[model samples]
Target chain A: MKPQSLLVPALVAAIALLVMTDPAMAYLDPGSGSYFFQLLLGAVLGCSFALKIYWRNLVSFGRRLFSKSRANRPSEQQDGPE
Target chain B: MTGINEVKGSFRDPAGRMFRRDGVLYRGIAPQGLDDYSMLMSSGLYEELCAAGKLIPHEEAASPQAPTDELRFIRPREIPFISYPYEWCFEQMRAAALLTLDVQQAALARGMCLKDASAYNVQFVGPRCVFIDTLSFARRQANVPWAAYGQFCRHFLAPLALMSMRDARLAALLRTHLDGVPLDLAAKLLPKRSRLKMGLLSHLHMHAYFVKKFSSGGAAASSKNTRTLPRNALEALVQSLRSAVLSLKSDESSGEWTDYYDNTSYDAAAMDQKIRIVADYLSSKAPAVVWDIGANTGRFSQVACEAGAYTVAFDIDHQAVQRNYLDALRSGRGNLLPLVCDATNPSPPLGWALAERDSLTARGPADAVLALALVHHLAIANNIPLESICDFFGDICRSALIIEFVPKDDPQVVRMLSMRADIFDSYTPERFESVFSRRFAIERSQRVGDGPRSIYLMTKR
Candidate 1:
């Protein structure tokens, strides 16, 4: 199942569990929806972490292009309007 | 004239003449203050103002201490607690800022104007802000443009604006800038967007600009003769500043440590039972002063105060402290005072080589300490062992400790461990009692309602 498709059911089940439980004596290990949110968030994070490697190479290429153009120019405050 | 020790600093006004005789503070009125002093007292305004806590209470000299030509020298009752402006929380500082303006406005209405708008002149009477400088008022001069206007902006406006516009932590800047933070520096620190506000632009940015521009030139010095605002405009300026100050509210509804109250295991019944137990204990112990540690919302501090003991309610939460302070003011509660303090890292001996103001530990060893609902957070959250917590309490106060123990099975403890690992395998009630019993003999322990938490009234061994 797609991670996004399970989000609604996971949230509904979490809320249902929390409402039914009363924590007077001792606190629950985690509130009902907590695990669902955590798992979903972990999946999203894992995908993003993989994407960062590709973005880093693109960023370095842009930096190299910009630096080479900057080094070709004179370092001076050119005349600008007040 | 019999002389007494003089207090230093900008208080050198009234002619470097503050004297402490037999532990009572007295400000000697210079010859200039003679007529105003007579008008202030004989007019019955001093009595009226002091009784209302609007002005510092003073009584005319019983002994004839005035010089032959000098008017009467009066002695005002000293404030029970002398807290400097720097030590005040954000709400306290804002209330003081507004009070100084109120005093100026009232004095102006009485045909007098405050000579200085120093934040040091105001202090908390319960939660109500009262002016402490009975002699700060002077007969108003026509067309003088309120000489105290610049001082007011520097003392109150600058610091408050910095707190609101920049960050609330900047209120501590008052500690460093005793004479009030420099307007130029405050303006510089504020984000550039704040300059767009008319009040900030005019009072801070423009005021600082003019101060620098004038101080550097001789023509501006000569121009002082030509510059004068009408009396009406001066009064309007005071009102404007008062509104501006009163409008600046704390950015956060709950200060950094507010969730603590919600995180606790206490239901309404458990809280009530704890208060009832503390009250009953106090009636028997009959201590003169009680220090309520981690006193959130001050519900139990009121119990101590109502029991005829002066209570100092100290809490780490700024919002809790602010709420407690405002409630005390609204209720006119004089016997209790709320201060912001992180018990773990309380205020140390500071100021003028560290003796001017007493540190938290230096100030305490109160008759008793109400450490209710505080042990678990210190033990589990802060990693302070239960036994060390008991020893720390033993060192601070002499007699009784009203503490609460929330077991690990309790929901609050489970919640604290919800997002974290359960490394505290030894956090059990039996173990807690074994460690704490080494120092304090547990006098009585009652389970709060049907909850797993129990309140203990322990006596130091």
Candidate 2:
């Protein structure tokens, strides 16, 4: 996938981290570290969702091409006299 | 995800739209909605209701700039948390229903009325019921039918009647019937004797009858002329409904899991020792939150809370949770919150797409967990393996386990084993330690007096 698609999810993860890791708290435990990693994993998973949308558009484009061919191949069969 | 953006519940009157952006929640009040909103606010009703804690307090939009296409935003006071009706127990729902009527009476005095009566509009702030939907108010039609009557019956009356007569467990029926349970179905499930009571006969039993009878025959099609009731009569009807609803009482007894503390095999010496062990463990680990699983009336949660830890006193028994919650409220205990939870099947993630709300597990991995008298049920009754149970706990918390291991000869385990085949071949104290030692280090363990049960304070490795 392109880097462009990954940008939104990466930003979301960074924002989530920033909100959670504010200066007021004590030292981070293993659990918080695990959760931070989970955020990044969530971003990677989010990229697949974006890819699926693009894939669907590509499939629809191919289907349109096939349908156009079929329409052209069946030309003038229903032409009517005046 | 769903209904988060779309306007739902009582807010339907104002073009059915309310939303929260960033942290600010807002409602759209159209020009048509303004008259009712103005009357509700200006007629001293808003102040009266807000003071009584009947309505959620809201301030005017911070800026004089009206909401428009270019910059459509109006900030209203935000609710801290939004709880669902299904999560509410019987008393909570009852309180909300009463509060709704109280608000209605206040609105009526101001020459306005509530356009909706959806239970979803109510949320609990501490122990009090506060109305969350500010846009539900509308100008009272002087001689017209109660606009929210049918909704009130479906949302509050039906569920309350069911809980009052059948079983308190029937309160969970709200999860299935999101729009509120059908009144007709409620009437049928209710005992035949319930129909004998005047309130039940009129509100639920006869109310269902008329609704079905009229709808089936399309009686409204026969006449274009509208039937209207006077404003005073409408107020009277509201009062009567309130009185009727309040009269319904739960015939269901306390939850079956009572007497857990009494039935425990611990003597006074052992109990004191166990409490001391837990208190010491708390001092060392110093967790902010503690979940006392199987915490019957919060005997142990109190110990943790006193140690400066916020305790969630969790128990399967409804009565235990009710008592715990009431005690916390009465004592003004800010650090303790009691919740009814079944360990085998805990509170699932509810609401739209299941992501909008957190489940018991999603909400937790508590700072620590107190599993006293809880392991046996998971082992004997539920047929869960000890290793699996240990792993589940390990996944949920960082450190500390205040747990008890009841031997096979223990009365509770014996009873659980009596009805079933003796399939638990490994249900021994030695085996319990060995299995748990795989994931948790046994920090401390002491057999409680002459009793076969042993309380262990284990730290997750």
Number of the top-ranking candidate, with TM-score as the measure? 1
For residue B382, model 2's alpha carbon misses the true position, in angstroms, by 0.8
lDDT by residue (B1-461, candidate 1, tens digit) is 46545454324454225566665776667676777676666666666676766887877675344444334557777665556665566778888887787777767777777777788788775666788777776766544445556667777888888877777667667767766788789889988987777667767787777666555445444433233333344555666677667767675655765665566567777777777888888887787778899998788899998988778888877677777887887887887778777778776666566655456776668788898878878888888877778778887777888888888878877788898887777778898888878888888888888888887878888
**Model 1 CA RMSD to the hidden true structure, in angstroms:** 23.6
lDDT of 1 by residue, A1-82 (tens): 5444444443333232223222111111211121222222223333343344346656777898999878765443342332
Model 2 lDDT, residue B156, Cα: 94
lDDT minimum window of 10 residues, candidate 1 chain B:
B222-231
Worst 10 residues of 2 chain B by lDDT: B220-229
